[model samples]
Target: MARWKIKNVSVSGVAMAVPKNVVKTAELGLLSQEESDVFDNTVGIKSRHIAPDSMCASDMCQAAAEKLLEELGWERDSIDVLLFESVTGDYRTPPTSCVLQDRLGLSENCFSMDIPMGCCGCMYAITVAGNLLTSGNVKRALLLIGDTALRMGSMKDKSRVPLFGDCGTAVALEYDETAHDIIVDFHTYGKGYEALMTPHGGFRHPATPESFEYEDFGNGIVRAPIHTLINGMNVFSFAISRPPKSIEKFLADYNINRDTDIDYFLIHQANKMIVDRIVKKLKFPQEKVPYNLEEFGNLGGASIPSLMVTRIADQLRTKETTLLMSSFGLGLSWGTMCLKTKPMVISEIVFL
Candidate 1:
């Protein structure tokens, strides 16, 4: 695990965009009534916004960036950096950031790049952008992070389909001399990478005949190597273990009082079970923790910002809110951070 304190950077605004299509678990037809009820009550997913085949992660992100830039009254030309973070990109090549730069009308000198990450992408991307800005080399940045997890999963895979949603979120950041410092702690477990992965279609295992073969895992879980596959037991175990420990250590190491210093705990919306466990272990009041999983399902890297836009936009828009954010998933990695956000522009949820 590693931690860093980034200074002179502040969150300016946040915005989120989701597909117009809504998939309610009860209507998915993949599960029986009894099963659906159990899933709703346990996993806590009621519906998920799934993007159509025609819309990619980049499109949603572009919409979000447009709205955010307009709301923040930020000039496109002033953006010194643009970070596109997500596992899903517009294409396998040409890097999605290049496309976004052209689409968003960023200046030719803008330092744009892509970070292929899952749940922890937002924090990681923010940390990277903060570094770029701290040197005064980059003045402003647009951090676009989200994923269409369902687009990568088999429609027939009940285990994954109902728990994943499509969302794109944009966060504006700028270098400010008076801004409070941002503390970030990041950790990774490479040995547990297989806990959550899309087994094929990478340079690693390149496409093989077997990659296309779909196997029924029984009980309605069916998928191929080309689709996202999650080892439930492995992920659940890791989620309930590592994240809480990291959060506690971050608070203690930074001399932060989780109960008082933090105004909100924006935890990753993995699932009710995983989230509930972590909150319980940390002994934080349920009211301090906000969630969006019930309506948007799990949005990978977009989870944290999506929560801000959907659940606590009012608070964030009204006053400075100290936040303790924690995220864990995909690479079997987790991150925890403490930051303060002044009353900022948090736009209404955009449905595309």
Candidate 2:
């Protein structure tokens, strides 16, 4: 079997949008006087952008795609495939990709669909798009990821509300047989479905008035009656352990060590603390970990790509850089991809 190679990968364009109002951790009263005393003992957040009442995940995604198309000078009909990734959608039926396709005026023959994943979404979507391009089935593909999970009634719960922010990201991938990029691995475990999920609004339990009533779990905070319930501690522990092990497994297969090896670590922006713990355990340089959670908070599936477009693209030079990109969260799902590419400067867009 012949191995796939990335001919050329350029983030042709990128854009992002946040809610009109900025919410700071201090305003949420998340820390006590004693908890706030220590210098490093912080609530792990400064501020995050929340979407306006009228904006949905799809709307934010559309804005990003529009900007990318303009910057790349891509005609609407030139898009061969559109992949939409998000855990939050406008509806359960009719994938959001269809809505984007129509809004963008893509050709009728274009292949468009949606992938519902949490934090790991962008990595997974890129892997899938790369495969389709390498198979000679498509010439160019667009990957859009955005989420309004924060707007879900469940996010109103104090614990989650502070951790999530609404945002969208867009990346354009063109077919390139000469490119040296490879998706090393991808995997998921659904057994932990109940451990983190919206308990009352899917096939198992349709939304009902009774289901929306708050019940005390003795945690002092009232759990949302209709929102997704995530066991935060459980999710955090699972995330910190999995990605490092997965990266180690990939390195062993390739027979490479960390020191004089990988150039960058573009892990998910799930949480500042989670990223901090992984950096320490993996012994990765603190500077290599690209963290945007402090300003953008958690954009769910959009986190990694948003960081790439906003921060990573602008800093590339002409050398083969090794990047270990990983994402883990909701669905208890996670994945990591190793990318090797020559540095190319990405043009920055003035985000609104």
Candidate 3:
């Protein structure tokens, strides 16, 4: 059990940018009419945004960051640290964050790096950013999370392709002497690493032309070894257990009530079945837990922040809110966090 109480770190702004190319499941010929209806109702994914081949994860991240920096009216050089979290970076070398620093025109003194994580990426980024701010070594930090990898998925994979959307988010955090503490808990089960993975393009399995060879497993899902693969059953089992339990324990330890103490539960938009199961197990009210999966599908680690920007931007901008965020999947990691926002700036969801 890894837990931390971060003080004097608060979010100043948040912004999300999704590719303009909207793709509804119906748009794909792979799914039957009945299957499309089932996916829409059960998965809650009516549509998703797909980035063009020309657009990389960094492009959307840069878009959101530029807009957030502009909206917050902060000088680029004022940012002291930047972490770019994503599974599909522009390249395998020269850390993507380094390119982002140049794209955003940040100071040469700013510390920049990349964190390669999937669904758990954003929460991990935010947690790390908060801890760094605790040291008072940095005045402000930028956490950029998103993924364009789904666009790289094999088009024939009926199971995983429709479950994803491309999105990038920029969250601005600054050191504050008076802000309340941010509580976070983390857990991992590396044994399930194979539950969800892309087997090639890494040093362990360098990409080869044969990596694109197709193998149909008799199931509807087809994968080229290089494409993302998922063990849906195992992933569903993991999601329905850890996330709800961790959050329940978090609220219990903090003496916070699920009914009222927490203003909202911004969980990873994995799917309707997984999300509804977690909510029911925790006994949290449905109204307080909003879902964008119907319109945005799963944005991986970007889902939580993307949910805030796309669904509750007005509420977050108008009043102080206590947010309970939970993230799980890929790396087989799960994390739950409790954060209080003091009416920060949340920009309109940018489409590009």
Candidate 4:
């Protein structure tokens, strides 16, 4: 296997638009005790970025991609490939990538597609771009991922109300001979499919009025029974076990176990608890882990790259730093990559 280097990896654009209104956990006091407890404890989310009534995943993604292209000063013709990775796509038929390409005014020569991974999407997309760049077929690739599932229901369902937020992130990858080394490893375990899933609205179980009806969970808070059933314990257990295992496997593959050998660790910002668990279990240094969940909640597929753009890219001082990034969730999938790179400028686009 030839080692592919990620040269000139820059986040050309980053923009996030939230619902006009913001809901806080404290505001959920009107709900029953069990409801409030689940919202506050398991979710551990104080607030999340809910999209406006009119916005969908593609709308936010296009807005972010436009800003990224503007910042990079590159025309649509320069991009050879466009990948939109998201669990909540704009439509079921025509892939969301097609809609995004047309919306962004990319040339018809550009190849566009969608990756259906949920939270691990950003990492998976980056891995694909890295391979394409290394394969010599494409010089520049645009990767975008986001989700707007938070708008699927009212704020009454405490189980999900605080667990999701909406945001889009774009990354520009270019081929550079002098760029840093990049290595990626992806893994999946499908046995736990029922553990965490949005069971309705897919080919397996098409959406029906029955799926939308309310069901009592022995509490005053009646929720759409099959909406997004996330067995918190199962999800957490899988996350805690898999992420560190992959990270360890990566380190062992490279024949090193020292903490200082790695510069930064960007784990998927699923929740503060998962972040803490991974760091503790791996015994990774505190500074190595970069977390922004408290501010952004969970941006689903966009979480990892968005953190890199917002937090990591700006603070990098030299080009030799070794960074480790991993994302896990939905599909019960996870991916880890070890990248060595030089500092590069990332443009920040203001989301109005």
Candidate 5:
């Protein structure tokens, strides 16, 4: 149980970016027209924005960060820390955050690093940034989180190709003694790590010539070793079970009243079935949990922030709201974060 409360840091703004290319579920041709319709209705993903080969996750995050900084009217030199989270970075060598620091024109003294995480990454990254601010050494920080997961799947694999989207998000935070506390609860189960992963391309099993060869796994699932491999049933079970339990414990530990204490529950947009099951198990109000999976698909780490920008930006920008966000997946990890946000800038979703 890695849980703690951080004080004196407040979220100032949020922004998101996605590729301009919109790929509708019907266009994938992975399923028959009838099956595609069923997938769209049951999974709640009708379309997704996919980045081309020329675009990388860093590019989208830079776009989002730029927009957020401009809207917040903050000088780049004022940023003291920068954190970039993504499973798929621009390269295996250079840490993407360093490149972003230069790209964003932040001060040379600014602290920059990369956090390679998956679904629960945004909340985890926020916690990391919040703690840095609490140290009193950092005055302002920017959190950049997203993934180009759509590019990691084989187009022939219906189970995965249609279920992922590319997106990038930026969150601005600054140290403020008067700010509300940010509480985060984290849990990890390494035993279940294999539930979702890309087994190839890493040092453990460096990519070989055979890694690029596609294999038919039946049921319209076909992929290369280098592509993502997900045990859907295992992942579904973990998503619906562990995350809800974690959220429940978090609420009880903090003595939070879900119906009154929190204005919104921004759950990760994993899928309609998984999300619905978790919401049902927790007995959380459906209205308070907005769903953008229908339009953006599952954006991995970007799902939660994308929800703020796409679904509740207006509310978050105009009123003081208490938000509780939970995300679980990949790394067999789950987390819940509670924070208070005041009326602040939320830039329009940038399409690249």
Candidate 6:
């Protein structure tokens, strides 16, 4: 129930890095001909980038952050805060953000932390970064969020396998005293936490040999508890329900006109179908909703930033537009935000 407005912060730039490897849902033997057709035509997944086995999520993030730092001409020491948001970290201990600080050659004084959440993470990281900058002590922050959700599922599991992609992104934010406020509305429903989770890898179900045994979950879907478990129906229900409702309330409460006040509605690219449903539910214009999942599948925490970089980089670089973003995912957590974007250096999507 966190409802607040934060000011004095603006996103300076956004950059994303995805693996060079391409994976088409059609190419993966996981889906049958009909499923593949549906996935490509209606569900919006055509191809996705898959990191090599040797690469971890942090590697992609570091690549993105490295390029962003260079482009923004930001010296390593000037970044006072860095937030890494993702469930897939290099290790369970030390927190990935701390490790990234060393890799990126950031100053030891940087306040770094990890937000171990998926999908809705980028915005959450922005929220944390904004708060820190407004505290009057911090100047600049690098907000990184992404994961290898595509790597979490067994290759043969058709249902979940084709629906995810691997990615890493960085959204740089700096304090600007005259910047307009960012309004965000947050909602949490712990009841849906189990709807999307790896039930066997966390503390309560720490890795065990028995956990590696694959079990069939019907509909040609089979996986071990160690793999990411997504209850499609439940997740779909939550996605199509909560985010739209929350966004409606967000717009209404702010007296923002969807048709005139906002230039774009950049939703977490879960899929074309889900975005369409939300669009249909809200009676929002379809043309203003830009999407990239058609080529990249669903990129977990990286979706929003990736979406911005891939689909609207040029517009964001030159136009001062109003945007409303809605993101929802695991934790049954979701949020809606509206901000008038200033000119930002949006880098082209990088394939590492």
lDDT of 5 at 172: 92
Whose lDDT is higher: candidate 2's or candidate 6's? 6
* Clashing residue pairs found in predicted model 3: none
TM-scores of all predicted structures: 0.98, 0.90, 0.98, 0.89, 0.98, 0.98
Give per-residue CA lDDT, model 1, range 126-172, as digits (tens).
99999889867778999999888887888889888899999999999
**Which segments of model 1 are wrong by more than 4 Å?**
none
lDDT of each: 0.92, 0.72, 0.90, 0.73, 0.92, 0.89
| Residue 274 shift from truth in candidate 4, angstroms | 1.1
lDDT tens per residue, model 4, 130-208: 7777656678889888888676543566555666778877777777766666777788888888876777777788888
Going through the candidates in order, what is the number of backbone clashes in each?
Answer: 0, 6, 0, 2, 0, 0
Pairs clashing within candidate 1: none
Structure candidate 5, residue pairs in collision: none
Q: What is the lDDT of candidate 2?
A: 0.72
lDDT of 2 at 240: 81
Clashing pairs in 6: none
Question: Which of 4 and 5 is ahead in TM-score?
Answer: 5
What are the per-residue Cα lDDT tens digits for candidate 5 across 165-282?
9999999999999899999989899999988988799999999999999999999899999998889999998888888888898899899999889999999999999888988999
Q: Which lDDT value does model 4 have at 117?
A: 85
